[model samples]
Target chain A: MQDTVLIVGAGPAGLSAAAQVAGVGYKAVLVEKEDVLGGAPILSGYARLVPSGEWARDAIGRMVKRVEDDGNVTIHKGARVTQLNGEAGRFTAKLSNGKSVKAGAVVLATGFTHFDSVNKPEWGFGTFPDVVTTTQVEQMVTAGKIACPSDGRTPERVAILLCVGSRDRQIGREWCSKVCCTVSANLAMEIKELSPKTQVFIYYMDIRTFGLYEDRFYWKSQEEFRTKFVKARIAEVTAAPDGRLLLKGEDTLVKRPIVIPFDLVVHAVGMDPNMDNPEIAKVFGVGLEKHGFIERGEHYTNTCGTTRPGIYSCGAAYGPETIDDSISQGMAAGARAIADLHGLTRKAS
Target chain B: MAIHEKSLIEPERLLRHDNLVVDGVDVSGHWNTMITPRTITDYDDDFEAVIQRYPGAENVHRCWQCGSCTNSCTMYAQNVQFNPRYWIYAVRTGLKDEIIKDKDIIWQCVSCNKCTSICPKDVRPEGVMKALAHWLEDEGHMPKSPSRIFDEEFTEQIYARGRIEDSLVLLNFLKKTGQPLVPQWLRVFGVRLMQYLPVGLGMRFARNFFIPPRTRSWGRTGEVLRQYVREQKEATHG
Candidate 1:
């Protein structure tokens, strides 16, 4: 039998895993829930990367095309793995489309969900006409239009609420949506470029400009885009009669109750594991972390494969992660799966 | 794939700055900033009492001021000095006055819950924040702020209506906070319209709100919570 690797969730992680497996002369079966797959980054559209600053559509399009044309790769659209069984070097996955595939290894690259802003009703996500999530803003940006969702008119003052559902303990979401700080900063700059007339205000606690992009992006956004970074948590978002949004927050540095009015409000919503992960974990006989992310062993041993041997997982399926990190992990998982298959073959001898 | 090379600090390095007294180490005039001669108070008694009250608050001591908690905090993205990690460190070591000095920020948390989720150890950061809030109030360092007033109003409103009444809560919150109404009549009217809907419709509008809703033993829930609190206290104390 030909050794095959099954990659689930065709986001950056899954695609990367498929590409890596193909490079190593192994067949990679890539499955995705949506017809198109770039995960949240693709969905949010503003992949306006610095350096070249290509929109997500173009960047992801090139990546997907590369993986699709690979002879060793099989792309399955509108397909989700409903079941995962067996151990490392030999496993089987049952898909929602009723196709059962036996594989030597499985890689789970399931990504994250946008934390529901409605939970923090004070931020006025569902209630306020102007309040929207980062995902919605991505759609607007992708359309080459930057207008208030509440009213189609161009917004003069815009407030972006950071850490909506992430980093909150009230509703039991305690993990930092790792990407929010960077994404918010990037989006704030993008919005400014899109609408020079719009004054952008970021209501934040501490601006995390970590890694290579940390303070570099922060300083650039501040000096270039003039994004007003505030040190205060917004208490609530209330709407006025004219449909403008009211943001109530404490300007902690100044120790004053600052009430700012804005024409548009974008919630820098954090990431959470997709809801179906728990069921998926049970089916695969794999353990998940408290946050419902796949549990990995030691950083090296648990690079991609789960505690259950023959079952490897990667990407956001573990938790909130970035596109680049997911791709790296996907490659790691592919290498691990191939090694396991090699080990299985050696053991038979 | 071009992998970004990240330097992983050793796990022990995570606790580098934790629990060390600055003996004769004057941070004064370093980095062009004058370090004030400060008296760091050891409110060990108060800290013990706080740990006694909220027994689970011991995790506050486990913090190493690594900025990880603050970095992970939703509020940290908003307020830099409202650093939960630093505040928890101050609280753990009985730096009561320093903690009280930052009391205004105690209410800034929306409890989006990212910090606790990302905490490598199960440190309940929100719980620690609440404990600090309680301690600040108990110590009488600051007067009743909007959040406290809001809490009182919420309790009274919920007690009276058997559920939270949004219109009343807002009105009472505003009335107590002494903030001028931006559009007083319109807000009231709009809320009234919201409330005028049938109970079913109202519940759908504000799921937690109820006017004539059925009441199930608030007394029982309170007692259960109290008992749970007591058990936690005893466990921690033991």
Candidate 2:
């Protein structure tokens, strides 16, 4: 039997890793917990990808197609690796779907979970009908009409709040969820495009659009789209008697308090570690960081390699990362896994 | 390190020796303006705790100096010296003298509640402003401001009658503040109101001034509220 590589998760990272593994003459078995491929952005129906205003389906579809077309790749949908056993060059992953696979190396691409806004009661996520998450807003954007969920009327004013669950010491999450700033900026531009008359306000403590994304997404949203950037973290979101949402915050730049009314409010929620991280780590006999991400060998050089030899991890499973970076890390993990398997083959010979 | 608020320093305290040289350097220009430094030994360490005893200032400890309160303050827009964030900082640090410097204007807060609404830490800075203003009067740093006199007159009427006679409260407030019974603006407004007033309503309004209205069956309600207020004051202060 040809040597096989086992990959968990069918997200951007997993799909890229599977494509690389299969292209390199090894049979790849990809397991996905979800019934369909393409992770959160595709599943939730993302309107457009950041930095490039392309449809998410088209971009993620290309990666999904590459992995599916490769004859060396076998994809098992709605399946999960319940237990993993053995070390490098000889590992077994027992799947939930009454199946098992023996592989030369394993890659854990299990991604992140979007932060639930319910944790922040002050944002009025569940209490108010007009309040929605960025993912829900993505679905609304995909629907091609921006309206209040409460009244189904076109929203004249919309407020987008950034850093919902990230970099908040009160919530015990001090690490910045790097992609929220860019994602919120992109969503703001999308709202402005869909409803030209609708006023869009982004309330943020800081706008960190690292690298080229700053110019393409954040700055463009402000300069080109005329989106108002308020340097303030909103304290509360209360419902007005008129069924409109009230956003309370102080504009730090102006040094004044502002209580504005909006027809709809979108929370740019941050990424949280997957709930199953500890269980998955224990099953795979791998180490996890304090934040519960699958710890890598060395951050700089061996980013994809896990503490256990021949085991690898990439994408949001390692930490919060953009789709583009996740795919790049996926390929890196595939290359390292191939090299590890080849060294084992040479040793056997 | 001490926070030196330049505006707080008096112009008289700043000494500029135009013709003096030290260490063979001519430092006699604008650069030579020297501030007379004085050591502050009196700090009311219990100042913040005392302010917290008042209603609305319970969350003053949560302020992270994010400046949200001052940034959103209504008074700060009119006067740059009216900084709620800086005052809170002084209160938190027990810098009694620093806070007392702005005693005259602290009571000018309009209580618009914009600061309370926007405070990310739930500091309820509007309430803190009220608490601070009240503390200023209680500590004998300043006398009762016109706004405080108005609030007390209005609130006392409410507690006594379970409701308020607007004209009585306004007249009592004016009397307590030693202002004219009818100011220039009120005279103009009263003249304009008389044109729109119906004869019967105007007669009733005139009667209200002579005989102040009181709530019917306001038996022990007034006594109970007064007792509660007294008890609360004792509990908070002592």
Candidate 3:
């Protein structure tokens, strides 16, 4: 049996997992669906990493270089796993490119899909030109300008609506998209820095910047950047006759209903289960939780181990997670795979 | 059904038996409290459009009912029934009966613009409140509210002359609204004012009240504005 680990997806989790596997002298096959590596944050154009304020490309590029330089790691970009067969220590993954890799264990690091803001028609995501998702705003940040999509003028006032597709029963997403609060806070600071004249208002049900990120991003967003946090979930977005977007929601803290016009509206969308989650779970012979994320054996002890013995899952494949958690989980999954493969090798000998 | 606001549910719909025995069990007071099942078939559909035709309420149809307007409303703090969000919802949903129930208090909006400033949807709920008040008056749902009478009295002076004499407007508004000209508070305030007033300042105030100051070249400007207002009122009401 080949002492190799097959890593599905080439996101932060998959790349870190592959790096861990290769570091342990085991061959690691990293299969990515996209033509390029990095994943959503890279493809969608994130300007900078949150809290650190480091350029996204540079931070992610360092990881990409580590994986590429390792001779034990093999990267197959623009490829997807078409088929999975066999059990632990004899797993084979057939690639879309007609290539197959037999490995001792597999790690599914497939990440999440950005929640589609269009699903919530009240946000006026697609209907209004100035109303855009957080991902789209990230692209604008990368473009080095925050301008109204309709008029191409610099937005004098921008409203960032947090938890757009998360924590709302109406959309069937009750779980909080963990990273959005920090991301929105970071983005608010970024936008403020980009255009100091522009007023940034964040309408949020809660500011959930858990851990040190709270002090680094959320606190800084308020204390340093002067970002206005309105404690309310926006009810609707409508375009004004003058091309500005109007937001309706209550300031729950002040207990007042408010309507304010903004030059641009940014919907801080959350993460949904990966679109290929069902298909991936089916092929891998794994189980999915109620939310469609791959079910882990036990979070505390067997954090990376999936319902299927040899098949493991990490990062957003399990649930909504931050990049740091994904990377750490990737390492944990890699360590588990290596240990499993070592046991098999010892038995064979 | 998805947008079931508890505030929108009328007290009449709430059924509660103070003392009751049901099927060998006592279901009294809170235990017996139930909401009557209701099927609303009286949607005016065109109510939102009609309200939108008012001067400030052009964007009434855009209410997503986040409850921000009601939450931030100045009038809402004093009276929970003065809910801009619920009224906006009623207008958008064409619940004419629901809106009519709150007609008396709808004109008490204070023009604080607090709702307009904080609304994320830019529904301009303050304007919607004004439009609703106007609609209630235009439709003859009730007599002109005291606030509307005060507005007309204040506005008519401006439309006729270049500006308004504060005393004239105040007295006229009081007369039109059928309030005592010399209220207890106003009498006390006037007495306090006289105690602090200098002879020159008091004489100037008296002269302004008697003569009523007018802006120069006001005749043509006033005529044009009067005609414009007349046309606008006709266009909106007709």
Model 3: lDDT to the true structure: 0.84
Error of 3 at B165 (Å): 42
- Candidate 2: C-alpha RMSD to true structure equals 28.2
Worst 10 residues of 3 chain A by lDDT: A250-259
lDDT of 2 by residue, B1-238 (tens): 3335556777657776768788998877555777775433222435667888999888776565678888888899999999998887677646677678788788899999999899876889999988988788888888776887898988898899999998999888878888898688989999999888799987899999999998999989999999999999999999
Candidate 3 residue-wise lDDT, A116-228, digit = tens: 98899988988988888888888888889988888789988888988887888988898899998899989988898889888787788777899999778876776567566
Clashing pairs in 2: A255-B71, A255-B72, A256-B71, A256-B72, A257-B72
Proportion of native contacts present in model 1: 0.00
lDDT of each: 0.74, 0.84, 0.84
**lDDT for A327 (candidate 3):** 87
Off by over 4 Å in 2: B1-238
lDDT of 2 by residue, A89-169 (tens): 889889999998999899999999888899999989999999999998888888998888887999987889999989888
TM-score of 1: 0.59
